[model samples]
Target: MKSVTILLYDGFSNMVLSCLLEPLRAVRDQSQSALHWHIVTPHDGPARSSSGLNIAPDLACKDVIKSDLLMVVSGYGYRQHAKPENLRPLRLLTRQAASIVAADTGSWLLASAGLLDDQTATIHWGVISDFTEEFPKVRPSYERFVKHPRISTCGGASTALELMLAMISEQFGPADAFIASTMFLHDAAQQQSTGRGPNRLEGKGTAQLRQIVNRMVETIETPLSLEELAQQSGLTRRTLDRLFQAELAMSPGRYYQLMRLTHARELSTSTDYDLREIALRCGYADASALGKAFRKAFGHPIRKSRGSRPH
Candidate 1:
């Protein structure tokens, strides 16, 4: 079981807090690994967010005994919140927690406490120059997030969600993380790469592309070759490839392979089927064949990714 503690402060960003909590909510619902969380403030009082929403603490920060993960989430007014009274408990809890994560200006608080002296961390980009000037010892990156073994930091609200998803995938396996992403319809990887929201592609030009995706979804168990897909869709192979690349951003063959692998992963996690059976059902030749592709896609073998079906 993983016990998570959120150390929230006044003037926090509600969106950043939600981004930190929502992925944990999804994993607690879908993960085989047990997870629990509690929210707390400096003195067990209500804290107001930047958007004027108030959150009452479940406990005080000093009351915390230990935590598997400690999340420090602050936004505006972080400078004022860096007093020794607040930083003292934060330093203690950070030392005891298995991992320490900070969002937005949260890294400012940690660095102020001397908790991140030797860590390479990222903070809200707007404050990079000030942060570097303030904390000469801590290396600051301008990336969306930085994931270190013991300490990690995210730059903003959306990156908070991205960091949580990666942590979820690490602790509960990629299958659970993928399932959690479905719950929110969040595509963090694509969003990061494209610097835009998910492309719905629900336009007149995408009718055929949508049909092709639907076909891929329907044929997960018996994937069709690119030639077969083209013939069935009344498209030449070149046209089929163009349609997928222009909309879905991958070739027909690559999409079909991914489709089959996803189903294979679902079965591995949610059912009692052995690897050989799952491979055959997902259109692979055997366990070895599926293992090769699965490792490539998820960076883990199917056996290691298996877990009790989430209740």
Candidate 2:
């Protein structure tokens, strides 16, 4: 039997919490792993999310028993909750638990407790610069997740799901992990699969198509022309067009344009970069060109996407 303990804080993301728990529960249901979890808080009672969803904890932090894995979950307003008194239990767990995982901004709390010194870690990208500035001893990564020997960190809910799935594969087997992923409608091949399975895009299209897409993703800041992309994929322009049309229902040019615009939208929402800077990063000649393309693809002005993000 593997035991897991989750320390929840007020204003934690309910979605992130569920992403970690649901897959493990599904694995337990299908296999004989006997995976169990206990939710703990600084005080024994309900912890509410920013959206008002409430979760009841099974134990107070001071009363938590040792577990194979201890995960700290934090979201908005994490700084206010990461006081010394509230972190005492976590500091104690560092010596007791087998491994510690930080989810979302929980990395900030762990670093505050000096648990991540000299350890490679990652927090949500939106706060990564702040995390690095505050904790210089902790090596911060731009990856979606980082897994060290005794400590791990994840950037957000989706990466947390990936981390848990990888842990499940290590404990059980790849087959069991695949089953759990399928239950969640997640295609394991698209991710770093735990088991030796076919990639999600393996049979969906030719290898050339996958290669072309990867190239586009890598060069988002300086996009390649359609002819250049075709040459790199070792295919003619016509074949590239045919393959993309058959596989993605769009031309290679359209798909590439959409990819760049999608990246532009992410930058707009997640960072404070101005339109001119974002446009240059996305390979646009100017802000006007970027705005025209963004509106065409997403049906809204770029400013609207920036304004819609939570303040």
- Scored by TM-score, the top model is 1
Q: 299 in model 1: Cα distance from truth in Å? A: 17
Please give the range of 10 consecutive residues that has the lowest summed lDDT in model 1: 184-193
Put down candidate 1 lDDT per residue, 7-74, tens digits, no spaces: 88899999898888887876664443468889988657898999899999887777789999999998
lDDT for each residue of candidate 2 in 1-311, tens digit (9 for 90 to 100): 38899888888888889888888886664443557889887566898887898889887766766889988999998887777777876787666789888999999999999989998999988899999999999999998789887889998888888888778777775544544554443232324244444554422345556567777877888999999999988899999999988965568887778667756776887899999999999999899999998776555688876864557
lDDT of all predictions, in order shown? 0.78, 0.78
Against the true structure, candidate 2 has what lDDT?
A: 0.78
Off by over 4 Å in 1: 186-311
Q: List the residue pairs that clash in candidate 2.
A: none
Residue 234 accuracy (lDDT) in model 1? 95
Candidate 1 residue 74 Cα shift, in angstroms, is 0.4
CA RMSD (A), model 2 = 17.5
Model 1, global lDDT = 0.78
- Backbone clash total, candidate 1: 0
